[model samples]
Target chain A: MKLHVHIKKKISEFSLAVDLEMTDGLLSLLGPSGCGKTMTLKCIAGIENPDEGFIKLGDRVLFDSRKKICLPPQKRRVGYMFQDYALFPHMTVRQNVLAGMGRRPDPASADPFLERFRIADLHDRLPEELSGGQKQRVAMARIAAQDPDVILMDEPFSAMDTMLKWELEQEMLETLSEAEKPVLFVSHDLDEVYRMGGNICCMKDGKTGNIISNEEFFEDLKNGNSELLPGWRILPPER
Target chain B: MNDMVNFLSGLDWSPLFISLKTGVVATVISFFLGIFAARKVVKASPGVRAVADGILTLPMVLPPTVAGFFLLLIFSARRPLGSALYTSFGIKVVQTWLGCIIAATVIAFPLMYRNARAAFEQVDVNLVYAARTLGMSETRIFWRVIMPCAAPGIVSGTILTFARALGEYGATAMLAGNIPGKTGTISQKIAMVIQNGDYRTAGFWVAVILIIAFLIILLMNVVTARHMKNIHRY
Candidate 1:
């Protein structure tokens, strides 16, 4: 599936302008902390409204300010994984998964996703009872259960420790790759973005730059073709 | 102590039962209406929210007698609404049990609304956005996620509302009047006995109200404490 977006919004201290298109592959939104990466994802997911322009997912028009057509997040069919996972604290893992299954909510349909994420055993456990890694897995399973057309992940690995991040990163890549849909992953860590091995969309001060392959992104940084941005830190791998 | 039991055995206990019934009915109504009003205000524009909040909370700050005056004006039988209800439904709010409930609900609604609003505001915004993106309807998101997360505050609010409703006197006095075994709440009963120079009877009712208030506070603390146990560090 193809996703297209061209939207402009004025936030405090900066104006965000994003225009990009992705078709059936992962694209990492590498940006500084306040560069509006998350805001872009919110606009795509219909959680936030854009001041102008339109957003399209394949043939459907998700939002168009000119026509006054704005679909709410529920109708967008877009999955958003919050930075903190945002699992329902009051619900068990199984119930949380069932929640994403749809309006009617068939409890039995949650089994395969629970099995895929290996959180079947933890289905009865509340979110507060789970570790950060386990919460991430549940969040993934919940999103997968939604069967969204596009998945947007905002700093999915930000909460975990170095040890857990490496292992979960592999699992996330495997699951996301198998989905074969347009995935926009947001992160400020250059190493994490590079490791994801997708086209990188660098954003600085609420403005997005051209989309480039992961290898070329590092090559440009090494050759000093573009100055190193402020907030994109490259950390040495932990031994 | 023997005298106190003797006094209780001879006392007209309808005020206690009436007050409890009024308190419960008012609390139940306030619980849903308060949450609904709070939700609407929270989502409203700034200008609308400020005005709406001020109006909703006015009954709490104003003298209960003033609230009673408005209730009297609106449901005074001479007024259109009062006359229409009396004509069509044969329900008389003035000097009746319904007046007790209406007075208590108006006087106690703000407690529930303010607490519910604060609790809802404290809920993480991302949880709502997450639920929406997961295809859960807005109604489901509210009942499933928001309500559970804000339960402690709601529970405390409910207790406070029930306490306020139980003690409602000024409005109940003006609108419902101190009709023994009908509209006479514990507060009204206490006031009436005190007016007759029956200090002993008034003291007994005062003690009952104090115990009820204390129990309400205890319940608030216990419920909130249990909810906080899993999250509190220090």
Candidate 2:
């Protein structure tokens, strides 16, 4: 599956104009904060409306400005894992995970993720009751349960300790890898990016300036094509 | 003095019952309307919000006599509503206890709305967002997330409305009139007793009212204190 997006939005002073196409698997929007990375993902998820842009995940035109076609976030079927995970505190882990289940709620799609994420035992626990790692797992299961066409993550592990982050990072990659659809994840850690294993898109000044393969990503960073963009970053390198 | 004592002592309690009947009904009615109006304001478009906020507060700011006049305008026999209530429904407002209730509700409504709106506004809308993301519809999210969190606010507004209704004077006297044992309220009762140079009777009723209002206020304070705690935690 492929998702195409061309978004232009002015957020206060800096304007973001993002035009990028991804052909399935995992695509990383590698950028620091305020680099328009999150907005690009939000445009695809139908959260924030861009000034002028269109996004299409296959035949579904999620957002088309000229036609004034804008599907709300609920209808987009693009699972978003907010930087904080945005899990519902009032709901038990099971209920949160169940949110993304099959429309018919066939146990077939959900049971496996719950079991895989190892949160099957924490089903009754509220979000506050769960540990940081458990919350991260529940987020994964919530996203996995829905059978979304695309999963979008914004700094998924930003709040956790490095160990917890690394631990959840592996779990996320494993679960997201199981689905056949595309996953567009955002991250600042160069190492986590390397661990996640995807084509990297380095964003700068509201534009995505580079889309380099893994080898090229590292080489450009070491050799300094990475320097062209100010505030450019190298995510935590893979161990 | 003995006759006055007997008249005050055996004052038929049915008027007290009727007064309570009006106070309670008025308070309940205003509470519901106020909550609805406040929720609408908080959730409304900017233009609608300004209009609703202003309209809701009119009862609070307008003279209770003005409210009586407006109610008279709205429900007088010559007016459409008055004509309908009198002719079509055979209902009456002038010198009627229900008219007192209507008058009381209008005056107390803004307190209910303002308090409830503050409570609702304090709620973190992110919780609502999180609920929606869990695939729950907006209504479900509201019932499950918004209302439970706003309960204390609702309760506080209810108590304030009840207290306001209990003390309502100008609109109740102006619209419903002080027909003893009929449209007359506790306030009217106290005023009439005092006018007749019945200080002992007035003092007795005043003491009794103080006890009752004090208890109610204490209960209201307890609820509000609990609500404040909830606001801090939630």
Candidate 3:
């Protein structure tokens, strides 16, 4: 499935103008904080409205400013995992997964998702009881349950410790490969983006750069091409 | 001790019951309406929200008697709404128990609305976005996520509303009047007894008020403390 997005929004700090397209693999949006990486994902997911824009996913017009059409997040068929995981504090892991399916208390349906994410044993536990990594698993399971056309994850590992982040990153890479859909992963860390190893869309000052292959992205970084990525400065050699 | 017992036996307890019934009915009505209003106002456009917030909170800021006067203007039997109700439904609010409920609800509703609004504002907005992305309907998200997160403030709001309703006097006195068995409340009873130079009876009523207020505050603290622990767990 293909996803196309061209949106413009006025933020208090800057005017966001994004134009991008993706299909059938993870496309990492790399940028420093406040560079509209999250805002672009929000626009595609229909969480935030754009002043004028068009977003199409697999021939479905999610948003078209000229047509005055804007799908609500519920109708966008786009799964989102927040930076904080955003697990419902009051619900158990099972309920959070079931919520994605929009089904009743049917353990049969929810069990597969929990099992898939390896969180089946923690089904009855509330989000507060889960470790950060477990919560990420539950969030992933919830998204997988929805089976949306596109998945948008905003800095999913930002809250985890470095050790846990590495562990989760390995698991996430496996999951994304199997997802086989347009996945927009937002992250500010160059190392994390490099590890993700996909098309990199660099953003700076609310504007998106060219979509470069992972090899080219790392190549440019290694060459100290800070012009392509803002908020990047090669460290001085040790004294 | 005997004199105290005799005085208790002679006490007219109708005022206590009436006040409690009024408080409960008003509080129940306010609880739903307040939450509903808070939700609406929270989702409304900024300009509309500002104006709506001001109007909703006006009764809490205004004098109770002034609020009662406005209630009188709307439901005074001579007014259009009051006349229609009287003619079509045979309902009379002025000088009736209904007057007591309306006055109390008007005076106390803001507490519920304000508290609920503040709580709703404090909710992590990303949770709502997450729910929406999960394909949950708006209603489901509201009930499942927003309500639970805002429960502590709502609980406190409910207790404050009930207490304020129970202690409502000026508006009740102005609209419902001190009808001995119909609309008379504890505060009006205490006032009437004290004005008649019955210091002992008035003091007893004062003690009852103090006890009820204390119990309500205690209940609030217990609930909030438990809620705080739950929040910290998150």
Candidate 4:
């Protein structure tokens, strides 16, 4: 699958202009805070409307300013995993997953996703009863149950501690590998970008700078190229 | 003590029933209307939201007698809305039980609206965006996600609204009037007995009102504590 996006939006302090093209596999949008990484994901998900330009996923035109066609998020079939997980506080794990099934949600149909995410036992428990890691699993499970065309995640592990972040990242890597959908992950941490192991789109000051493979990113780092770094000065790799 | 018992036992219990009926009906009407208005106002532009909020909350800020006067102007049988209602549906608001409900609802509605609005605003907006991406409709998200998250504030609002409606005196007195068994609430009953120099009956009614108010507040605290426990569970 291929996803193409070109969009511009102006907030009070900065104007976001992002153009990205991705093929099937994991892709990371690495940037500092307020560099428009999350805004790009929001635009692709159809949550935030762009001032100009078009977004296309495969054959479907999700948004086109020239055509005056902007599909709502529901019609776009794009799974968005929020940083906070955003699990419905009132719903149990099973019901939360079922809510993502759209119009005629069947409880039994969500069972496979629940089991796949290893949240089968937690089905009857509300979101308030779950741990942070479990909440993330449920969020992923809910998205998986939807079976969307593309997945956009905005700083999914930023809330967790280092230990939990590592554990959840390993879990997420496994899950994303098995899903085989085009995934766009946004993060501010360079270590997370490297650990995610994908093509990296470096963004700075609300603009996309470069699209490089993970290998090229590491090579650039080793070669002491500071252009890829946004605000922070380039430092030697800890490893 | 005997005098107090005699006074309580011989009291016209219709005021108790009338007050509860009026409070329940008014609270129910304000509950839905307040939440709906709050949601709409919250989504409006800042200027429109401020205007709407000011208009809605005017009754709560103003004296109840002023609210009563406005109600009378709108529903006084000779007025346009009052005449239209009476002519079409035979519904009368002037000095009727319906007037009591209308007055109580108008006076108590702002509490629910303000509380629900604050609660809705305090909710994590990302949760709404996430729900939208999950293909949940707006209505579904409001009920399933937003309502549950705002329960504590809404519950407290409901309690305050019920209490205010139950104890409505100035507005109910002016709009509904103290008509023996029809529109006479506990507060009106107390006032009526006190004016007639019957301190014993007025004291009993005051005690009853205090007990009811305390119970409502207690219920709210219990629900709030339970909500806190749920939050801590995660």
Candidate 5:
């Protein structure tokens, strides 16, 4: 399936303009904070509105400014992993996992997701009781339960420490690759882009300044000249 | 025999039972109305907010007797709505069990509105957005997530309302009057017994009500503690 987005909006604080034609695989939107990365992701997920845009998920015209067609988030098939994971504090992990599924409580799908996350034992625990990693696992399970066409994650790994971030990053890559689905994940970390990646778009001034395949992205970074980059705050050690 | 005599004599059994029933029913009705009013007020435009804010806070400021006069006017046969509710419906609110409830509800509205409003506001806007993203309809989100998360605040608000209803005196006495078998509540009973110089009976029931009120306040404190504990850990 192919997904394309060309959106423009003028808000009070800032404005956003992005154009992307995407297919199946993880595509990390790399940008510094306040670059409107999250907002762009929200627009694609149908959580926010863009002033003008054309967004097509495969043959489905989700949004087209000229035609003035916009789909709300619910109608759009999008799996979102929020920054805090946003697990319902009141619901047990099991209940949270089963939230998207309708009435009468289906255990058939829930059991496998709990097993996949290795959170079967944590089914009874609330979000507060779980560690950061555990919460992410539950969040992932919730997304899997939703079973959307495109998975959109905004800073999902930022809450973890370095070692844990790397470990989780690896797991996310392996998982997404096996699924082979279109994804748009946002992060400020370069190494994370390197680890869990397909294509990279470095954003600046509300637009992507650089778009390249993974090999070219890593080689360009290895050359140690970041002026070609959009908004790279950290430079790697010499050589 | 003396202990049994004291135990039996100590109870103003009728008023005690009436007060409990009145307090519960009043709190429940007002809690629902308060939630509805507060939600309506919050959704109203800024201009409407000021008007509703003033109107909502008005019942609290006026003396209970003044408020009673207002209700008197409200339920008076002159008014079309009041006549319909009382005459056509066979629902006699003046000097009846329902009038006591109506009085208590008016006083309890502010507590319910303030608490329920604040509880509902504490819900993270982001979480609600997330729920919408998950394909959950607005109604489902409210009952499933919003209400459950705000349960502690709702419970605290309910306790306050119950306490307020239990202690209601001025409006109830002025409006419903001291009909001992039907309309006389704990507070009205206390006022009547004192007037009659039945210090023994008045003092006895006063002590019972004081204990009940104190325990309710204490239970409210416990609810506050539990709410804090549950709210903070997340």
Candidate 6:
């Protein structure tokens, strides 16, 4: 699927003007904190409105300022995995997954994602009972059950330990690879962006700077030319 | 010991019942209205929120007598609202059971509203956004997510509201009046007994009131503890 976004929003002391387009792949929007990466995802998810812009995903007009067409988040059908996971603490794992499928969701429909995310045994447990990794799995399971047109992840693993982060990343890659939908992952960590294995859109000062392939990103690191973009840093590869 | 026994045996129990009935009814009305108003005020703009909060909380901050004065101006038989109600529907506000409920609800509503508002504000906004993106409707999110998460604060608000309504005296005296076996509440009864120099009867009622208040507060704490257990421990 194709995703196109050109939006401008002026927040307090920071102006966001982003214009980018991408085809099907895990596109990472790498930026520092408060650099509008999450805001861009929020705009696409319809959580925040842009002062002026148009966003279209595979012929669906999600938002268009000139046309004055802005669909609410519920109508957008975009699966957004929040940074903190945002799981309903009151709901069990099964109920949280089914909550995404609207009322009267077939219980059988959530089972597949539950099993895929390795949360089948924890279905009866509340989010409060789960670990950070387990909660992330439940969040993904909820999104997978929704079966949206695209997925947006905002700092999905920022709170995890090193070992759990790596493991979940591998598991996430396996799950997302089979889905075949455009996934926009936002992160402030360069190592994470590289490990996710997709196109990289380096963002700075609320604007996307360069769109580079994963191979090119590695090549830049190998050639010691990784300092080309601001707010992009290279760290040692994971053990 | 004989006087205490005599007071208990011949106690005018109507005042205790009247006070409880008024408290329960007022608490019920204030519960829903306070939650609704708190939700609205939380979503309003800064300026509008300030104005609305001030107006809603005025009755609580002012002396009950001042609040009674406003109630009188609005519900007095000569006033348009009171005249319309009295002439059209034959519903009287002054010196009526309904007046007790109205007075108690007005005096107790701000406790519920302020507590609920603070609780709603503490909820992580991202949870609401996530629910919306998951295709959950606004109403569903509020009832399923917001309300359950804010249960502890709401419970506290309800307890305070019931306590305040149960003990309401000055406003109730002005609006409902202290008619024995009718509008007289435990607080009014205590005042009347003291005025007649019946210290034994007044002291007996005071002990009963203390016991009831303690029991309710203990019950609420137990309920709140259970609810708190369901919340995530960080």
Per-model DockQ: 0.86, 0.30, 0.80, 0.74, 0.61, 0.90
Candidate 5, overall lDDT?
Answer: 0.83
* Interface RMSD of the candidates, in order: 0.8, 3.1, 1.0, 1.1, 1.3, 0.6
User: Candidate 5 chain B — worst ten consecutive residues by lDDT sum?
Assistant: B225-234
User: Against the hidden reference, what TM-scores do the models get?
Assistant: 0.93, 0.81, 0.94, 0.94, 0.90, 0.95
Candidates in order have lDDT scores of 0.92, 0.79, 0.91, 0.90, 0.83, 0.91
Candidate 6 lDDT, A214-238, residue by residue in tens? 8897778666676445353456568
**Mind giving the per-residue lDDT tens digits that candidate 1 earns over A140-176?**
9999999999999999999888899989999999999
To one decimal, what is the Cα RMSD in angstroms of model 3 from the true structure?
A: 2.5
lDDT (Cα, tens digit) per residue for candidate 4, span A54-104: 999999999999999999887899999998888887789998899889777
The residue ranges of model 1 lying beyond 4 angstroms of the native Cα positions read: A227-239, B1-6, B77-91
Candidate 2 residue B107 C-alpha distance from true site, Å: 1.9
Can you rank all candidates by TM-score, best first? 6, 4, 3, 1, 5, 2
Per-residue lDDT over B1-234 for candidate 2, one digit per residue giving the tens place of the 0 to 100 score:
888788767776655766688879988898778878887899899998988799889889998999999998998888898999898789999888878899989998898989989989988765565454445667666776788778878887788788788878888888898988788787778898899998866786677678768987898889878645525463
**Model 5, B1-234: lDDT tens per residue?**
897599677665788877889899989997898888877887789999889878886777888888899998897666777789867787777888888988888887788888887888787766777787788888888888888877878888888889888888999987777788788888889888889897877887888888998998898888778757746564
Rate residue B181 of model 2 by lDDT: 76
Q: Candidate 4 versus the native: TM-score?
A: 0.94
Candidate 6 wrong stretches, greater than 4 Å: A221-239, B1-6, B230-234
Task: Tell me the lDDT of candidate 2.
Answer: 0.79
Which candidate number has the best lDDT?
Answer: 1
Candidates sorted by DockQ, best first: 6, 1, 3, 4, 5, 2
| Residue A8 accuracy (lDDT) in model 1 | 98
Q: Quick one: how many clashes does candidate 1 have?
A: 0
Candidate 4 residue-wise lDDT, B1-234, digit = tens:
897688667868999999999999999999999999999999999999999999999999999999999899999999999999999999999889999999999999999899889889988888888888888888888888898889889989999999999999999999999998999999999989999998878898899999998999899989889878744564
| Residue B31's lDDT in candidate 3 | 97
Error of 2 at A31 (Å): 2.9
Output the number of the TM-score-best candidate: 6
* Candidate 3, DockQ score (0 to 1): 0.80
Clashes of 3: 0
